[model samples]
Target: MKLKLNQLDILLEVAAQGSIGKAAKALNLTQPAISKTIQEMEAEIGLPILQRSSRGVTLNEYGQVLLRHARDIDRSLHQAREEIDHLLGKAMRQLRVGFTSAASYGPFTNTMIEFQARYPGVKLVAMEGRPHQILDALQNQRLDIAVLTAGTSIVQSGMYYEPLYALSNTIIAGDQHPITHTTSLKSLMNYPWLDWDEPGEHSILAQVFRRYNLPQPQNIVHCSSPWVMARMMEQADMVSMWTSVRLRFPGYNVNLRPLALREVLPATSIGVLCPNIGRLSTAGNTFLEMLRINARDWLQQSDAAEMVARV
Candidate 1:
């Protein structure tokens, strides 16, 4: 069956919004218009796609399959447009890169600078987002490469990843926080804390509590931005866990200090998540190589310093 791109787009939007009226509002079309489009698509395909009820609508089995192909088609169209623009000399070679908030503060910044210097004609589009959002973009082909904290789910998602460095997370607070002087976990619990906006079951804070056999800390604030967390700690008697490396970045709350704990949290893995390396554009591949070199250099320097301190 032949279907128009607009029809497929409408169907995808309806499935996403789960309400015809909401989808119409989002797409800026009338509800009747949207209904007609869906009807036409169903007629062309010879099967019902959506199951409607009093509450809203949901995709049936057929709708699921159609939505998946629609997304693939959308990606292809975007690539085709980019290619045409490039051929017309209207677009520069572009590499879209995404990074988790923590990844942005490190040598990745230098990698971007070096990549730009090496390929002066390439256009860079960098974004900072949570790991899940970055991963979604990578899977949808919206981003060329993403650097993020490597988690089990990321490794299991079937994406290609190169481990960059290992980071140990520790509780941090304003340098002047009274708890910084306290060596006991009990004393540390007296202050309110902040945590990343993650599920409690999967949170580093929860893991710390379990390790110490302590009750969950009270008066906690959940924040998503590392900058927000740093600002809060600078202004209040709050605590939160972050990569030790994150705390070391210049201009990232010079007043923040890692709490001295007898317990050591497991190190987190940081990595580059990407599609097949062979599929990346020349600009994308060049930037990826720069990332590898920068990561290796920083990790080696850190190791050397640690060894000297030990000696």
Candidate 2:
């Protein structure tokens, strides 16, 4: 409690940026001032806070532990500020949610049901958009929270990302389709693909498609719904991709065969995103907690298979 907040902030900035100079620039302080503060703080803690090398600075283990404590300290400070703001009647009571979809990975209904049941008094506004579009809305102050998925996706400016769960991709073909054995990237293209009809654009899947020098799999038909794709695959000589999670859902009606690929597919990591700069509403924090806890519980209930799509 007696520690200086300014010093703690400086250390966090440095730890986060991994460069004292950059942290100093971020906090609008000179390099010498930043270095001096770090030295003094390390003395106070009686240990070195960082390791220096050609790769840049990284927090020492002891410093990392203290950083966690620092974050809790700062969070308490923020709560105090929020209480003061509420006393002035300036705090918001509503939450605006935005998210993108992988219809195949639909657990939002369960998540929404639990959220509304727990926070009956909070106003909820939900919007659906593509991944980039949802991020844009969050940056422009149109949304309070989002759930999105990307591979090795970086959190953009003004938001914090808490990873939720990973969805693995798998390739499926109709029961009657000829190839069910481990199909090489070349061999699979011998048959037409049952495809989702999105315009040709640079995406993780598209990138993989290009890497293999395969033309967009010639499709006999196109649809967006995985369920529709699933049904179409029942009798067609086509193959499609799905999250292993969706394909294995109990009593799922799809009758498709999994194709063998050479390497394990890369997973799509999903996350809950929220504003990093402003005060947190009680509702926003609660929703984030619910998302993480629920996703953890869901993972416990299933045995997942590795899928075919890799980024």
The candidate scoring highest on TM-score is 1
List per-prediction Cα lDDT, in the order shown. 0.79, 0.69
Clashing pairs in 2: 169-307, 169-308
Worst 10 residues of 1 by lDDT: 302-311
Clashing pairs in 1: none
lDDT of 1 by residue, 5-118 (tens): 999889879988999999999999999999999999889899999998999999899989999999999899999998875764432378899998667645688898898887
Report the error of model 1 at residue 20, Å: 73
Residue-level lDDT of model 2, residues 1-311, one tens digit each, is: 25699988987898889998899899999999988987888888788888999877888998898799889988999999888868634333677888655522445546777878876766788886656667778878898888876434336444687766677766778788888677765677667665443545414555457766666655435554666677777867777765665565543444776788874555667777777725566677777777767666666653422431323
Q: Lowest-lDDT window of 10 residues in candidate 2? A: 302-311
Candidate 1 local accuracy as lDDT?
Answer: 0.79
The positional error of residue 60 in candidate 1, measured at the CA in angstroms, is: 67
> How high is each candidate's TM-score?
0.63, 0.60
